[model samples]
Target: MSRRLALVIFPDFQLLDVAGPIAVFEIAERYRPGSYDLTVEAVEGGQIPSSSGVCLAARPLSQGPLHTVMVSGGDGTRDVEGLQGIVRWLRTVEVQRPTSVCSGAYLLAEAGLLDGRRATTHWSRTDDFARRYPRVKLDADRIFIRDDDVWTSAGITAGIDLALALVEDDLGAEVARMVAQALVVHQRRPGGQSQFSALIDLGGRTGRFGPLMDWARANLALPLTVEQLADQAAMSPRNFARAFVVETSTTPAKAVERLRLEAARAAVENGFDPIDRIAEAVGFGDPERMRRAFLRAFGLPPQALRRSARS
Candidate 1:
């Protein structure tokens, strides 16, 4: 009678949404192979196709003492036909084995499972979830949210963070740390941090000044000053700044920081570059400025982010 973890897979499944948590859980199981059971269960009883054309099969929605049942989210999950099955199954949880995951928050919202509960979904879906499920306390800016038995996350990659949190709850923080280390990831990843605190939450194509955002994301390393941006848009600094806030729900400077931080994150994730070099390359003067900015925006330092990226 091993503790079992089930992941609900469906068509248009975000492949990473399915893979990230599975990878972390499998990596954790590797430490003591054969200790726990892990299975990918299709919510609607079929070999479901993912957005990438991969087919995933599963056991029929089970009604057992499942320690953890994960709901993955993606473009395919827009409708509730497949997810009603999961919500119905969860209605039977005996002790609630600390279930959670990213993008899965949408389905929970649909089931009325998140009413009055704090939760997070992918930033892109935050507005839609808010519009659809007003009773659910939604925070698009957070990576993951935990309220008693139910847990949710912002997007696909945060699934790893959710998995790490579950491991921490089950085996203790030390084991979770070991699991994260084994997976080359950080265990204590902050749930409050947004998926891309500094990246464009929009499609980068909204507002009259949307072109500026698109340009900024592409050239984050450049000295993107108010003057430069206003010049590009052929508007005065005062006029453009005002219009920007109205259109994007954030200021231009803040948007630039998001882009810069996103760039820094990519650099940290891909290679072993010095913090100073990374800071400079990402448009900061040095590690100190980047550290403060990263801390302010992401609640983590450049080094910590680099370590997490490496992990």
Candidate 2:
């Protein structure tokens, strides 16, 4: 049976939020013919201009059966008044899965669908979303969150990750992997991965530490103590520690650990290195120590994470 997949959009919706998932489903349909029937719909049918000013023709929201409904998010979501019709429809629409991308989570929460459910959206919207919908348990760090049948993803390109996951759930990992290969994107970034990398956020936030972080990544096997990092930065230990915290809003030790975690997790997921070897290479020193770190940061042990990545 072909699953009927619908993407909901509105004026000024993020174009990529709609295109990315549509491309995933479209490619998956090619691999498994008769697997999916795709539709784009709006509260009112016809041309809807995206945030980029590109327009996509959409069908009017209808009472027809839908297997999955994904709502696209963008600057338009800020117009709460204009979204009432869509919100009202979502309140009553029945689907196998109800999902949103980026600020689209706002609509689901507005419709009361996310009440008492764990969800996530673009990091920039987390504070506003939390204040607006206190009942929804918002995890602002995830790439995407699947809380039972409802799914929510972080901003923009994360929508591709969410769609790949949906494909994996429906067609299995092998097909999902092939679809991703066809798209020339990574097979998948597990939903549990952070929406943004530590190095990118901290390194580029100020150029002062970019070289240090890069050096630390390259020398992960070394003990990246604050004293060493301070020396590398040409500052005394005390002053460097103080200045680094002021610049990055995190202690030097914490930043180093985050950098280590990023490297270790990548190696764990993408390579077949033994967990102990991986831990040592990433400066965690002990397998158990790495396991604890992974659990605290990613909610999974190394082996479990490796298994999920391969799957």
Candidate 1 clashes between residue pairs 3 or more apart in a chain or in different chains: 121-154, 122-154, 184-311, 185-311, 198-258
For each candidate, give its TM-score against the true structure: 0.74, 0.81
Q: Write the per-residue lDDT of candidate 2 for residues 42-70, one digit (tens) a residue.
A: 98889999988999999999675689999
- Identify the runs in model 1 with alpha carbons over 4 angstroms from their true place: 33-35, 95-100, 172-174, 177-189, 197-228, 236-250, 260-292, 296-298, 301-311
Clashing pairs in 2: none
Candidate 1 global lDDT: 0.74
User: For residues 1-311, could you state the per-residue lDDT of candidate 1 as single tens digits?
Assistant: 35688887767888888788887778767765764688888755778888889887767766667777788888766876656766666666543554445567777677667889998887666677788889988776677878887889877778888888877776677777888888777445677665644335552335465567788777767899999999988999999888776565457787788778778877876778888888888788678988987897667887877676665
- Rate residue 144 of model 1 by lDDT: 82
Q: How large is the C-alpha RMSD of every model relative to the true structure?
A: 4.5, 3.9
lDDT of 2 at 253: 79
